[model samples]
Target chain A: MLHTYLLSIQDQDPTKPLESFGEKLSYGGQMLLLGMATVFAVLCILWACLVIFKMLFHDLPAKKTKTADTVEQTVTEPVVEQTDDGEIIAAIAAAIAMAESECEHVKFRVVSFRRK
Target chain B: MLDAIKNFLGTTGVAQLFADSNWWQYLVMYVIVGVLFYLAIVKKYEPLLLMPIAFGMLLANLPGADLIHLDFFFDDYYISVEGGKIVGTLANDFTQFLQAIPNALYSITDSSIVFDFSEATLASAGTTMDAVNATFQEFLGNAATLTDGALHIKMSHVIKEVINNGGLVDILYLGVKLGVYPSLIFLGVGAMTDFTPLIANPKSLLMGAGAQLGVFAAFFFALFLGFSPMEAGAIGIIGGADGPTAILVTKELAPHLLGAIAIAAYSYMALIPIIQPPFMRLLTTEKERKIKMTNLRTVSKVEKVVFPIIVTAIVCLVIPAAAPLVGFLMLGNLFNVSGVSDRLSKTAQNELINIVTIFLGVSVGATANAENFLKPQTLYIIALGLCAFIISTCGGLITGKIMCKLSGGKINPLIGSAGVSAVPMAARVAQDEGRKADPSNFLLMHAMGPNVAGVIGSAVAAGVFLSFFA
Candidate 1:
């Protein structure tokens, strides 16, 4: 009788081979690891997809040719001051002269400057 | 005078009210509600959500009231007070308040009508039984659960209980029970959100993924602590620090634990400033905190418009269970960026979200009756939620530190802690820490990358858990 009861107690749990928190702990650990792996995998794929998408669609910078590089002198913007209209005009004149030199064969025309 | 006195004593619920076990529970719940009110109002701890929740808790725990009871929708649930005649004491005890009631009021079967609402379905306790009996006959064999061979009650026992049974709060609770409120809230969140940071620097997605370690860790803890797997899932998602996500997961996994989990999640979110900084400082060195990230390239309008569509496809395909939340979120973002429908975007961001927030907060609060809220398990849930938040912050910081080193010191570890999905709040904390370390460092926009990614990461984790447990 005692032997049968003990067997019944041990065999009662049909779901898992382990008992109580032990079974849950094992399953929880597996899920924990799996959850972390899946989250990372999903996010990483998203990250990669975004990178690829951005790169594929992004406007690639125009390739630098010898003439293009020679003509394209990087001009820094002059910081504007409230009362520096004289200095601003001088800076504009210098930029115009440089641009005129870049395309020496073209005739230069000036337009009126109106601050909006 | 002697007859009137006898009648008052006989009709009043003063006898059974004190005799019931729920009396002390109600008393204690009142005190608890008072504290919540003080915290929400004076202390301003998440007052937007907390104030309504606290008021709901107060309404639910008020003695001698059936404003938020689980009674059915039969005609017997109400009392007829037409012509000011005391014809019925259906279920509620009106006592002296009966004089203040309207000509007609709906009362529960076993109580007298104490309040008045023009919208209520009214009947007499004594005279309407026969007619109500005829109506009850249609639902007689519809649904009933056997209880001690006497009282039989269940869902089909009532028809349209959402509207008929619940006076005010119960009507709002329908959104919460059906998971509509949280999903709608996600739409508003999506509209308000700007994903440019995440788009500019996609690598922060890994840090967002890292922060979710706290979510699964807490699940493990809850299981060991003896919660069922479903209950553990609800408790665990509080670590995600995303209130709507927590509500959605709990509504699926363990609806019973919803109130406690929602309260813990929102309360802790409000406390992020106090809760996260210490762990962040403890996890990383001063030098690492001072590292500044280079400026992100300006994201174009096309990228913004298409980003939501791609993310929705990937997330939904990967975790179909997260479709309502992540799908709505992405949809909201699409509406915002597509710029075709300014009306829809404005609605989602402001009017729709604010309305849903009110319903979600009060309804969630109403679910926490004295019976459920006043328990040892509630304390355990609160503690476990706090631990989960702390561990999640630590996880993000730890990953940030590693990433900072791997990038040849380009990444600031401070931004990693923002990966726990508290939105601009967590990001702000990172910026604050960065500013403290070096006055010139501006980490706000940089931290936003991981912060927004954390939202997606948590939603994905929620989907994974839902697949397992739901």
Candidate 2:
């Protein structure tokens, strides 16, 4: 349909002068010119699409990000001594150190109490 | 010494100083330039351009000022260095060089060296700047920017060479050559127009056609008043108020009458509301003026897209001469209607229209040089243009009354006046007047049918003129 319409337009008023090879033409010539114009127009659209996509995806990410509330709570809230795997391991190590320190203190305290 | 100074102050005294030379002629020119500046600044008529043009005219007229004509110095090449040292002679004779250089060798040296003349074609194609370098070499013969360095062109030598080769030097100052810039302007015009309005309201095509009543009416009036057919046609188009169309028609039909026709058209177009309303009101009564119109039916997207294509085929087939104006208008409208390309349409309506309006305004204004414009016939053209506009308004309003009667008062007679194709201006006037009668009445959309119709009516009228007279 488009091709037929364009052909009909070109066919209208074919009184073009022989000398008017490159002379000023009417609207009919302009319509035919747009057929060729579409090619460059498409190329321009493609270029614009690439630029927009690059802007969307390829730029550097933000330097500072706001942590989600859940993650923030996990990191900031102090763990109870027996809270999780890391806390439990630290608790165990602390208990062992306390036992060793208390061994000397306990013997001395007992001796003192007995002597008293 | 005192007598010489006194005589210098007097009229015959100044004439005696130049030995019967016309010195007052120089003073008169300065006076004219001064008046132009005064009018530009005080009246604020086209201040943006007229001020600069007037200043340029003054500076150019100053004895030994030699600034604007510095370009003329480039017309003839002179050897110059950074420190004003003379160098080898330069040549600006592009055509002569082309003639001398064998086409075969020249093509090898630079296949692009030959003038294409198609850059102009491309510029019209809306492909601006691709061929600027080629344009500089071939058409202008002037180098690109002066940053390219001090250029030399041997004008005297080129003239001698041309004479030796039996060519004319008048061809060198082809700066003001005929047919080049005007056509390029037409190209720019073609690139910038949208034809969708005429397409959307195909019935409004008659409005444009109807508006050209003024063109033909003015033509016959001018002819009856002893102007030639060409002059008559040129004057008649002034009512159309289309600058490029006026330029194209005049350039073809009556190149000499371009100055008057252009001034009358632009001036009247600017004064559309003031010039057209009285005529509209005078022809119709207050009751007819206050008639309300219904809202325009919503146009479909498909219909909008199809409009430009269909109108172009139908209108151009019928009247080939109107193809340019109608084509551009429809094209501009097409851009507007094409939902996929809002950017292009916005550019056409905003940037392209703005830029072209400025150029079209000033260039046409400048063409109204003193000698061409200061004539009894120019006054006649202006008066006839007014009559044409009034008659067209009457034609539209009376036709609108007929439509109103035919459509059983459904059609507003006021909108008939807008059929003069001042676009939304006349339509807005109708809407304004309708609102005055009844506050809730909104006639703007209704008025647009005929408003857009007026543009087509005028183009069809121009085509009719072209068919019969051009």
Candidate 3:
């Protein structure tokens, strides 16, 4: 079965010449036109499909952005803890100092302290 | 002892070369092999494939090393079988039939024969089995009738012969002949390829298609040079700038020219850096080259996963003949982008591709024996192959210029040359030229869009040829 198939591929003898130069030329021209045309058409269709995909999936990244904003909000909220009042005051002062050092123009202060 | 020494000397390769009339051909082949080795090892021009191919050529040309017998594959060799018994050889020509009959009889009876027959009787008879059998009956007088008019030689018989009598390379060559190795290589290529750039910018696909201008151009030129249509089609595919695609097409359309076409395709591909730059510069102005366009949009994971599926469906539907090459290619790509089959993807990308490359390179190299490679037409194929590469670069550049104009100078004309499908190499050349025009202008990612698209484009072009001619 394998040999039969291999032989079938070889059946078209490459040595056999066509009848005339005119026929060869005509065939060559036709193939050139047909080959180029088919390639362009197929790729063009693929291009159109990609364009549609972009449109369909356009909103996905935006949804991802909304989730990212919620994560940011949760990260920025302060955590409450049972501790000494003095320790809390000292922690706030150190945090303000670090923030002020990073941004030289900004001044930070503790507005209020509560035990929770 | 003296007689034994004489016999040994008579069987040696040196003795064979001295006795053969065409000894110079072998010497020339050796020099060609040496040059290829120098290119592969010293120049570092696709060393992985070129080294194996060069060595295979050397092995084939060795005087006394009967590593491959081209006649077994060529010459329309066939055998007829009847009721599971080996019958007579089926050859259209009387001379070939007569030459093959002895072997056929030996395979069947497992005994030697001393038979006499007049050539005049067989020559006068027609080539049909009935006519030949009648002639044989007259010679043997009472021998049993042979054959059932089935003309094909069973592949099993050929495989048995290869295992029993053929060389190592012959066994390996079956993969190339059956069109298995190239497609498998594409599978690996697909696993390694990233279609993100192409997916991000879909317009690059048109540039890829435009770059195929050289494929048809070379086809027409080859036809004018007196190659048969099939041979021309095989030669023309060298323009695709993809070696496996060229090899698969050539093996199917013109197996005899595989060696020449393969060598030409690879050598020209290695020379792309030199061959494409002049055309890229000649076709596009400085202003056009410096045009750094907007960045490609980010392709979502969902789009990446769906890209290969859509391409495979549309391309296979449009050109069914392209399915083997294109289907395997997309399958490989899917394995890569799907992100689920990491193990299968890794194996295809590394071990599978490497093994097939060695087999494909060497077997394809084995086809370049003295008679096939040392022809005036080989020179034509080499020249036409260079022309194909140059024209393809120009094709891409021209399309790039048109796209630049149409998009109101938002596109860089330099990126067009990447559509010739030399992968990242062609794209890098575009980036280099673009940077020379303006240091800050980056075209690598932009050019990659067209570079990957060119891979698909060339595969489609190969399918078109197969559909028309195969």
Which of the numbered candidates is closest to the native, going by highest TM-score?
3
DockQ of each: 0.19, 0.01, 0.23
True contacts kept of each: 0.45, 0.00, 0.59
Interface RMSD, every prediction, one decimal place: 11.3, 26.1, 14.1
Name the docking class for model 1.
Answer: incorrect
- Each candidate structure's TM-score, on Cα atoms with residue i matched to residue i, is 0.73, 0.53, 0.79
Candidate 2 lDDT, B352-451, residue by residue in tens:
6555445444444444444445668778987998887777777677777776778787766777777776555666666656655665555665566666
**Tens digit per residue, CA lDDT, model 1, B12-117:** 5555457577788878887878887887888777888888887877766665556665333323343344544544333233223333333354343433334323
- Candidate 2 vs. true structure, TM-score: 0.53
Q: Looking at model 2, what is the TM-score of chain A?
A: 0.28
Q: After superposition, how far is residue B279 of candidate 1 from its true place, in Å?
A: 0.5
Across B327-389, the per-residue lDDT of candidate 3 in tens digits comes to 999899999989899999999999999999999888888889987889999999999999889
**C-alpha lDDT values of all predictions:** 0.76, 0.51, 0.80
Runs in model 2 with CA error above 4 Å?
A1-116, B1-203
Judge candidate 2 at residue B207 and give its lDDT: 43
lDDT of 1 at B104: 54
Per-model RMSD to reference: 15.3, 25.0, 13.2
DockQ for candidate 2, please give it: 0.01
Q: Weakest 10 consecutive residues, lDDT, candidate 2 chain B?
A: B167-176
| Candidate order by decreasing TM-score | 3, 1, 2
